[model samples]
Target: MKLIHAELIKLASLLSAWIAAGLATILPAAVAVLNSRSQVSRGIDAGFQDLAPGVIGAIVIGVVAVSSEYLVEGAESGGGRQITTSLTAVASRSRFLLAKAAAVAVTVALLALLSSAITLTTTSLTDETVSVGTADLPRVAGVTAYWILTALLASGITLVTRSGIVPLTFCIVNMSVVSVSFLLTKLTSWANYLPDLAGMHLFLRDVHGSVDIAPLTGGLVMGLWVVVVAGIGFIVFRRRDA
Candidate 1:
């Protein structure tokens, strides 16, 4: 419990978390407002679809949690890394990782919830034709779950790499520039089961792909990926020297 609290405090202190919060809230809300006010007619699902871009924020949350620990201090600070101190204090790698992961998950879930509320409300006010009601609660919950899973995926990758560069770039690019997995869907229907693609079904009514994934099935598939990545990261984190 102490470890979890400490980890949460560490996350709260990070500027990256604040930047991530901005991405999660601002991007979606801005998109919703634009969709609402624009002359171009969009489906009533515009608000929900806007949530897609916010995954970048979730990815950032995961990467920075691990990456921040690995950052080496300058020579003036004895050129040491925080991970060494963290491990020295905790003594148990599993406990430390678990606590850190929990912290990241909690931070991301809250961000997701906030983003959903702001974005949905923006849409509802901007376009009276779009209504958000109790029925959308489940989808909102799904969005939070999706963000948690996405954050975990980023955390797992960062743990193994011990650096944020690769994981952060890949995840941000995948969500922003172009989806490598989404492109693969053209060649194989099974690509529809990829984490991001499947996860989108949780809140999105219209996914531009050939395969049709039920929300529950998509969540299951994404969850499976999270388990696999987390397991691999745990093994690597345990065996590798800090």
Candidate 2:
């Protein structure tokens, strides 16, 4: 409990978290407003609808939470003073990482939920799209889980490279490439099993024209990936000199 509080404080104290959280809120809100204002003269565009503002804003949250560590040694939120404070508060490396991960998950989940609400409400005001409902809960949960795991995986990669810029750039490129591949129908079968794909599969149910992977399968793949990456991160963090 103390460790978690300490980790939460460390995260809350950082400028990066403030900036990322603000952007996470504002960018999506802005997009939702724009989407609401844009004319929908044609038919319902499922593709545009699937590209929800929350989903896009999550990309930034994912990158910053994971890669920010590299920018400030021992501080996932990125600041020298806060890093020192965190270390002084929590001596166990495993505990520290675990606490940080939990903090990030909680904070991001709240952010995602808020952004989703904003996007849906704004789009609703436009009358072009109906707000997502209980039927969409499973898919929304999946996207949130995927975002947390993706951030953890990014952290693992940062542990390996120790360069924030590298991981941040990689995330942008990887997401873009994945988005492009999603446009190819022939690949949806296997692509549906990919880490991010599983989440997207749930987000835009019509992407593959059907759910290729069951929701359970998607959750399992995402969970397993997080476990594996976190294991690797733990090993490296324990052995490496900080």
Candidate 3:
């Protein structure tokens, strides 16, 4: 509990966290409003489509949370990294990692819920044609879960690299408007199995072509990927010097 509390406090102190949280809350609404006004018609899955870019905020949150620990304060002075202090205080790498992950999970989950709600509400208000039925509840929940998993995926990747730039660049680029995965899907059906592509199946009801999998199965596949990468990160973090 103490470790988790400390981790939360540490996250709260970062400017990046505040920016990420704000983006997570605002981007969805902005996208929804744009979509509502656009003359081009979006199909039934418009809601999810508008909300998708908001996940970038969750990704940033995850990467920043872990990478901040490795930052050097003053190269000339040789001030130690924050990870050194964190490990010294906790005295257990595994415990500290767990606390960090827990803090990230909780924060991203709340952000996801807030973003989803705001997006859904904004979509309904701006576009009366868009439905907000109870039937869509599962899709909303799936989006929340997707954000949490994506955040964890970023966290795990950051742990392995010990730097935010690599994971953040790759994730944000791959998830952008001209997504690498989307382009790859045009070439090979197997691209559907990519982590982001597969996970999006959970909430995306109208994925036009490539490959189709059950929502639960897609979640499981993405979760497995996160577990494998996170496991490798854990091993490296345990054996490596802090």
Best by TM-score: 1
TM-score comparison, 2 vs 3, better candidate? 3
Clashes in candidate 1: how many? 0
Instruction: Give one digit per residue, the lDDT tens place, for model 3 in 1-242.
Output: 98999999999999999999999999989999988998877878877788889999999999999999999879774777899888888887889999999999999989988888889888888887887878988988889889989999999999999999999999998887567887888999988888898898889978754788788988998999899989999999999998
Consecutive 10-residue window with the lowest summed lDDT within model 1: 37-46
> How well does candidate 3 score on lDDT at residue 119?
90
Candidate 1, residues 23-109, lDDT tens digits: the string is 998999998887787887667467888887898999998999999998999999999999999999999999999999999999899
Looking at model 3, residue 207 earns an lDDT score of 73
Instruction: Give the higher-lDDT candidate: 2 or 3.
Output: 3
The lDDT values for all models are 0.91, 0.60, 0.89
> Which RMSD does model 3 reach against the true structure?
1.6
Clashing pairs in 2: none
> What TM-score would every model get versus the actual structure?
0.97, 0.76, 0.95
